[model samples]
Target: MSNEQAWEAVVVSKSRAPLDGSNLYRRVTVRHDDGPEEKIRVAREAWKQIEVGDRVMKEAGQDPRRA
Candidate 1:
């Protein structure tokens, strides 16, 4: 399948250095049709929040792949 057809997104919470030492950064990646995937990365304990948003959107019949 084409990238667009195989679209998927991931939200990640990962650690950084210095300012974040041992802390995690939350990130999300959403696929697009005519350009690079969209990515939003942030700090704080954001994994649950981000994932919940994703799930809500999905359950509401919104396809994250279509933008």
Candidate 2:
């Protein structure tokens, strides 16, 4: 993968789970642009901004962004 290129994918599912018995961890499952399923961890705000069927993109070193 090229650092300058971004991977674009569609959201398949989203979830939130408990961490350390108190904190919440948010994640999204996506059908990747390259044809594999991957889970991406996201910030609370970003997770709220996405839903099933929403589009997202990921750069080499950053969190997924809503598209």
Candidate maximizing lDDT:
2
Error of 1 at 4 (Å): 25
- So what's the TM-score on candidate 1? 0.29
TM-score (all chains, Cα) for each model: 0.29, 0.81
Q: Please, what are the lDDT tens digits per residue for candidate 1 over residues 1-67? A: 2223334444322333344677554555543334455554443444334552242122233333211
Poorest lDDT segment (10 consecutive residues) of candidate 2: 1-10
What tens-digit string does per-residue lDDT give for candidate 2 at 1-67?
4446679999999999996689899999999877898877889999989999999997877778899
Candidate 1 C-alpha error for residue 27, in Å: 0.7
Off-target runs (Cα >4 Å) in candidate 2 are 1-5
